[model samples]
Target: MNTRQLLCALTVCSTLASTAALAGNAPLQQVQKKWAECQYSTPDGDEKEQCFQHAITRIGSYLDKEPGNPELTVWLAINKASLAGAQGGLGALSLAEEAKSLLEGVIETSPQTLDGSAYTSLGSLYYKVPGWPISFGDDDKAEEMLKKALEINPAGIDPNYFYGDFLAEEGRDKEAKVYLTRAMQASPRPDRPLADKGRKRDIEATLGKLK
Candidate 1:
């Protein structure tokens, strides 16, 4: 082809590529906004759950458009897991299982992408409920996941707080106290709450027991 024709072709190609990139980012940005909303939707647990679900739906769609987006997939999984925790009931188990699988896929793709958030979700899944007759709670798994989370983000309040609860529930208050104190130290503010209040209360009660 002529030089001018080749240059025109390259410009068109670049424009199309840029447009596709912008399109991919559009959904991701929307999903992230919803995720931030979910973080502070504490007073209305159900609303918080719905906000996360909205994030999942949006991010899931983004993943459909960009199937190999490991970070987005992990975020979607974590949000779904959070939704399950915010509104735990009959069907929440199924949702949690789905989140677990998605996060596992994220780990498979890139363990580094299985960040503190992903591990925290897994930890909560295991820590919050009971086994079999009760649900999907297993303190052993909780400890494992939470420890993994802390390994990734040791300064994270969620990991420290929940891991403390896990230890306390297992009657290991000595170790649990270390985590609880760290959680309080990491606490953001009254404006931006940490994890779930109920979970935080559990952590406090566990610490109280330890004291």
Candidate 2:
């Protein structure tokens, strides 16, 4: 090939490589945005359940391509947890269990990924699910994981909010108020307006319960 033709081909290849790298995480971000929409914007009902189901399928496809990626795995877990909430029955238990397993795997392999989101999510499952013969819920484990998450991302909204909710559930109203207030005052996430709004509303409701 001529020198000029070789140079043009090299430039094309470089541009394509750059473009591919830039878009590498685009699918992950899209899944995250869709999850926020499903969790925060969709009302609790069959429609919400369907939304989560679709998200699970999409994330599953991404996982098939990226396999064992902490970010995708965590989102897959998050979607399953949300689906469990929307399902809310014996069937929900299995989804929650799956989510718990996925989050545990992420924590074991990449504890610091997504700013300790795996810890936050695992802690949430620990407290929210049933216990004993029913499921694996354990308040003490929940506290430990949530506290670890807080240590990693002290000002993060999800960790603070989940920890506050756990505290509220444990009847530590004053402590719950402290964390919930911090969560409410947290800086808004540029890409997560719906989640921020919904979480603040939740904090307000939880605070009202203390009053």
lDDT of each: 0.73, 0.92
Residue range 5-83, candidate 2, lDDT tens digits: 9999999999998778659878877898899899888989999999999999999898888889999999999999999
What's the TM for model 1?
0.68
Per-model TM-score versus the true fold: 0.68, 0.88
On lDDT, the candidate that comes out on top is 2
Clashing pairs in 2: none
lDDT of 1 at 133: 78
User: Model 1, residue 6: displacement in angstroms?
Assistant: 42
Best-performing candidate as measured by TM-score: 2
Clashing residue pairs in all predictions, respectively, total 0, 0
Which residue segments of model 1 deviate by more than 4 Å?
Answer: 1-33, 42-46, 114-116, 133-135, 187-210
Worst 10-residue lDDT window for candidate 2 reads 18-27
* Model 1, residue pairs in steric clash: none
